[model samples]
Target chain A: MLAFVLRRLVQSLLVMFFVALLAFSMFRFLGDPIAQMVGQDTSLQERERLRVELGLNDPVPVQFARYVAGVLKGEFGISYRIGRPVDELIAERLPATLELSFVAALFALLAGIPMGVYTGLYPDRWLSKVLLSLSLMGIALPTFLIGILLILIFGVNLGLLPTFGRGEVVHIGFWSTGFLTISGLKSLIMPAITLGMFQLALIMRLVRSEMLEVLRTDFIKFARARGLSNRAVYFGHALKNTLVPVITITGLQIGSIIAFAIITESVFQWPGMGLLFIQAIQFVDIPVMSTYLILIAFFFVVINLTVDLLYYAVDPRLRVHGGAGGK
Target chain B: MNGMENNVAAPVADTAPALLEVRSLRVEFPTRRGTLVAVDDVSFSLRAGEILGVVGESGAGKSMTGTAIIGLLEPPGRIAGGEILLEGRRIDNLDYERMRRIRGKEIGAIFQDPLTSLNPLYTVGRQLVETIRTHLTMTEAQARRHALDMLKEVGIPAAEERIDHYPHQFSGGMRQRVVIALALCAGPKLVIADEPTTALDVSIQAQIITLLKRLCRDHGTAVMLVTHDMGVIAEAADRVAVMYAGRLVEIGPAQAVIRDAHHPYTRGLMGSIPTIGRDVERLEQIDGSMPRLDAIPPGCAFNPRCRQRFGRCEREKPSLIGQGDRAVACWLHEQGEGAS
Candidate 1:
């Protein structure tokens, strides 16, 4: 087991490296950051000097190598326009985005799972029908619209909660621990709910349908024949088999949540990596933008790898196969 | 000996009452065509320590009969008419909760596929413990002990250690044994094994049969064994009931049916069996398939495929006849024309 875990870790490193390399090159080649940086009134010599200083004149391989080395060393170069360290910009904004995404995921699972399980267990029943109708509405309505509506009702109209900005600051001694504490939590709720509604709607439906299919399997029938209680037949046996597909969808949705965050965070003005990304793009801050892109890519790869490993834990059969986590 | 048949059959009816009595049992399914009578007025009784094999091809309603006994048939199919009496107590009208309570307690069932008869997620021990607890009202530790003992009794190798393993860890035969163990865990008086050995390899199939026979004998559990394999019936069954078109065409002692088949369908079935010693061109095949129950033949359903079929055979539906000891359903015997 230790060897298996070690092998997976090694594989993860290789995967992360390739992912970082591809994201970096694509951001560099597809759009010309230098032109965006130089702007309207720049002399040719000045621009050339700027380009050579940034190693833009170097070969693609050399450029990539330097970028990777710099990233590892925590010196992500100065933003071309903002002139701030790219790392600082990212560090400032990442919390908000993560805060939103994590809350959304939590809401999705907590709300969606029971809703899905109920729907699957009792198809067309009143409670299931109500949940289905609610999910359908959730799917149709956009996340940004939901966010706006929430702000209007809770923040603007009722004045119960703060609408736009992060909540009032509370002083704490430690930055690392402080971020996970009360003040941070208070600031995160609105944005998290905003981003979470749509995901909850989508994931609930997937889990319900997959669970319905797994319930009809012969194994479930056997469980029933074994004189297992209704609870055991439905939840213990049926639900366990359905988790594999659910985990896959969750992995895919994490990537989508990141994409959705770009829009949701922008709408809510929550300072997260997504907002940093848009700022980097608009100002053509190449170092900041590239770093943001690679970071998102790294998260995607990491989330999927974690999901694959969880599959092995959930299903004993997959533990024997070498590619359980990889697959 | 032939002239003194009355004396030979006189003592057959003085035996003990049947262990299971399925009286006028009717199972129906609501299909697109209409209400299809899957098992039409089927009635039979099983004796303790006897294997009663029900033989029929697909759509002959053999499986539905088994499912009906266990109350496991899903919706759109229901017991339209009948009384199911186990140990002479009526059980057909019991609600789902009550029926489930009686299911693993009084009666146990093994399905066609062994893979389906065991949940793949749980360990063998867990499943056995679950059933044993449900029926026996034992404590957790007691249940675990019983489950381990059952696994051993089922012939699973290293039952104490291997019971911790999941269903996929065992072979098909082993899985069937686990199923048997579960069925017999509550020490039910009756066991319904529906094609228990069909999923196994040929050699493994024999082993399972031998094991089942030995176990059932030891426990004195009456068994209603449903299968299409005549060989299995000949080898393991004490009595045989041959069904065609949702009706029992003939039922008698296993030896009687194998040696002296009364119904044309039974004769055709026996002739169709491929024997090792005898070489014949194209084993005797029944001329036609079973008729759709919705539009059953005007008179006898099997008359279309029967070679002994006569004018009266197509005009009248034959019912089971004869005294308690001996029974036959045919026009030839009714007229005393085919009587020996």
Candidate 2:
């Protein structure tokens, strides 16, 4: 198991390297950063001086090597627009995005699994039909639209909650989070719902279909014949078997939830990396944009590795050779 | 010979109530075009400690009859018109909860594939203990002990060590033994074994058959053994019921049915068996396959494949005609003075 984890770590590192290289080269092609930084009226010599200061005068390979070396030493170059270290800017916003994704994932699991089990158990019942249709609507409607609709209902029309921005933040060392305050939680609801809606529907459908399939298996029939109660048979036997596939899908969905939060953040003005991303793009801040891209790619690899470990933990069949002992 | 003697002794004292009784049981499956009859007017009874072997070809409805009695028939298929009585109390119409209580307590079921029957996620001991605890009141420690005892009873090597192992750890025959142990652990009055040996090897099949017979005999639990192997019935059953195309064509003491089969279908089945000492150019086979549920002919479902089929056999279905200690569903048998 240790070997397996080490192997995965190496693979993830290779992936992150490729992702960083791609982002670095792609931004260079988007247009000269110095040109975007200086005004058009500036003298040619002033522009040339700015270019030299920024090390834009160097060859492409030399620049890439310098960038790689800087990144290795934990230096993501200063943001051209903000004139601050790109890492510090990202670190300030990291907590919000992390908190939002965590809350959204928790919401999706708590709501989606039960809904899936219910619909899977009784596919023809009226309640199941209604919940299934609602989940379908959740999937069909886009994140930005859902965010606007939520604002209209709870913020604009009902006057029950605030619609835009992080309300308050509590700083702990380098990490700052909004969940420590009541207003922060209230503001979190709309964006979290919008970001979570698609994941909820996807997980529900996955779990429902998987449960339906597991319920028809011979082991389930044997479980029923063993005189287990309907509840025990459904939840204890069928649901347990359904979880492997559900966990796999849910793990993959977490990566998508983070990606999708960009639109939701835009709609609600939530202070997260997603909003920073849009701002960085608008200002042509190549360093910040490239850092964000690499960071998200790194997150995807880590999440996938965690999912593989989880598979070993949950399924005994996968833990045959040395896996059990390692755990 | 021992099985035949047991059969003769079965009816000696007729006062004891049958452990299981099925009266004109019909199971049907509803399809897009129409309802397909899977088990048609099937009726049989099992006395306590008696093994009734139900032998048939594929699609003969033998397994369906067992599933119907156990109330585990897959949906779209149901007991259309029938009564199943256990100790004189009707069980065919029990609700899901009540039926669940009866299963593994009153009537235990053993399916064909051992690998599929046991959950891979759990240890053998856990599954056995759970089933035992569900039907009986016992502490977890006591249940675990009982599970270990059952494993030993089924002849597992080193029961104490093996009980903690998963189902995949056991061989095919060993797994079937574990399944048998599970079915009988609750001391159920009856066991419905559906082709329990078909998935096993020829050598292992005999071992499982003997194990099942010995266990049932020791516990005095009646058994309904559903299989397509004639050899298994001959060795394990006191009485045998021969089914053809969802209907019982013959039922009698194992010796009588094998030696003097009255129905043409049963005769053909016996003839199809290859005997070691007897030499023949080719084994006899029934003319055609069992008819599909949707296309079963109007009269006797077996008429298309029956060699002795007559005008009456092709025009109308024949019900069981009772003789002394035997019954045959054939027009020839209906002509006898004692026919019913």
Candidate 3:
């Protein structure tokens, strides 16, 4: 078990290294931070000294090692556009993005799984057919369009909810949460729904197909024959098998949720990292843009590691020794 | 030898009422083209502790009949016209809850492939314990202990250590034994074993068959053994029913059926089992494949393939006709023994 975890940790480190290398190398060519930070009247010699101070002229490998060391110590330098430490800038917006993504992910799973199981168990039912048709729309329509439609319905026509922004956030230590206040939650509804809709539909479809596939397996039929109640046969035996594939998919979907939150954030004007990253792109803020890249890659690596561990937990076939597979 | 004929046939039927009985059972599958009859007018009875082997080629409806008896028939195929009774009570029309209650408690099933039959995600012990708890009112500890006992009963070595292992950890034969253990853990009165040994290595087949026979016999569990292997019928079956294209062609004492098959189809089946001493260039086989369900000839479904098919054989289907406990579904036996 320890060895398995160690192996995953080593792989995660390797993935982080490659992503850091890519981010550092790719973001440098987008003009220069010195040009963005300094005033127009600054002397050429002053600019050169600043460049040397920032180690811009250092060898690529040495700079990378220094960048790696700095990242390991939670330092992301100063954003070229804001002239504030990039870590501090991200920390301000991190809560909003994390809150939105987690809520969206939870909505996708809690609602999607039951819908998938229901549709799978009774593919011929009227309700299942209706859900399936509606899900098709969910998948077909673009995320931004869904957000616009939601805004139109609730904000413009019905006028029941706030249209944009994280309305009223409550500060809790390092975190700022919308969940603690009604106005904040009400404002969050449209964007969260818009962001979650596609994932919910995808997860529902994936789970439904997987449930169908698992139901056809011999063990499920054997489970039925063994007189395990319909509940046990369907959920206990069939659903668990379906979840193996579902877990891998849901993990990837969560990563995409955070990555794609840029569209939702821009649509709602939610003050999150996605919105910051977009601004960073416009102004060529290398530190902030690169930090976002490294952060997203880190999320993927961590999620994938968790997914592998979940596989070991859910499936006994993957357990090589007697240690980790607790009876 | 003519001396083999005995009126006291069907093993234990004379001593006790049938544990499981099928009266004119018919299974059908509806397609866009038509309703296809999979098992047509199949009727048989099994006495407690006796083994009744239903042998046939692939697509002969032997497995279908077994699945129907256990109320686990695949969708779009159902028992369109039939009455399956266990201990003189009709079970075919029971609701899902009632049927589920009966499934592992009174009637258990073992399928062809053991590798696929057991859930890969669960420990064999967990599978066994769950089935036991489902049918039997046992506490968790009691069920676990019962499961261990069952594993040992099915001949798994070191039940304690191996019970925690998953299905993939076991060999094919060992997996089948675990499957058998799962089936019989509830002490079901009847077991429907559908080609239980067909997927195992040849050397392992005999061992599984022997274990299944001894365990069921010791438990007084009547078994409907469905297989295409004639040698298996001869070895383990007390009585045998030979089916061709969804209908029973001959049924009698296994020895009698193997040695003196009255139906030409059964005779061909016996002849096809290659004998060691015979120097024939080719083995005997039916002349044609089974007619497709949609296009089955109007009379005997096997008539086109039967070498002894006559004018009457092609005009009308024959029901099981018998003397004492023996029966044959063929035109030759429609009248008396010598009518043909």
Q: Could you give candidate 1's per-residue lDDT for residues B1-340 as a string of tens digits?
A: 1122122111134368777877667888999878888887666788888898999888888888888887888778999886788877888888877878777777888777887667666787888888888888899999999988888888988888888877777777888888899889989888888898888889988898888899999999999999999999999999888887787767778888788887778888999999998978889998868887787896678888888889988987776555444455676666535444
Off-target runs (Cα >4 Å) in candidate 1 are A1-11, A28-52, A57-61, A168-190, A320-327, B1-15, B276-282, B335-340
Candidate 2 residue pairs that clash: none
User: How far out, in Å, is residue B231 in model 3?
Assistant: 0.8
Ranking by DockQ: 3, 2, 1
Residue ranges of candidate 3 with Cα displaced over 4 Å: A28-66, A321-327, B1-15, B276-282, B338-340
All candidates' chain B TM-scores are 0.93, 0.94, 0.94
Query: Quick one: ranking by TM-score, best first?
Result: 2, 3, 1
- Model 3, B149-252: lDDT tens per residue? 99999999888999998888888899999999988999999999999999988999999999999998899998899999998998899999988778877788
lDDT of 3 at A123: 100
True contacts kept of each: 0.32, 0.47, 0.68
Candidate 2, residue A10: how far the Cα is off, in Å: 0.4
Go through the candidates in order and give each one's DockQ.
0.26, 0.46, 0.47
lDDT over C-alpha atoms for residue A8 of model 1: 70
Query: Over the stretch B86-182, how does candidate 2's per-residue lDDT look in tens digits?
Result: 9989999999999999999889999999988888777899999999999999999999999999999999988999898777778888999999999
Can you give the TM-score per candidate against the true fold? 0.90, 0.95, 0.93
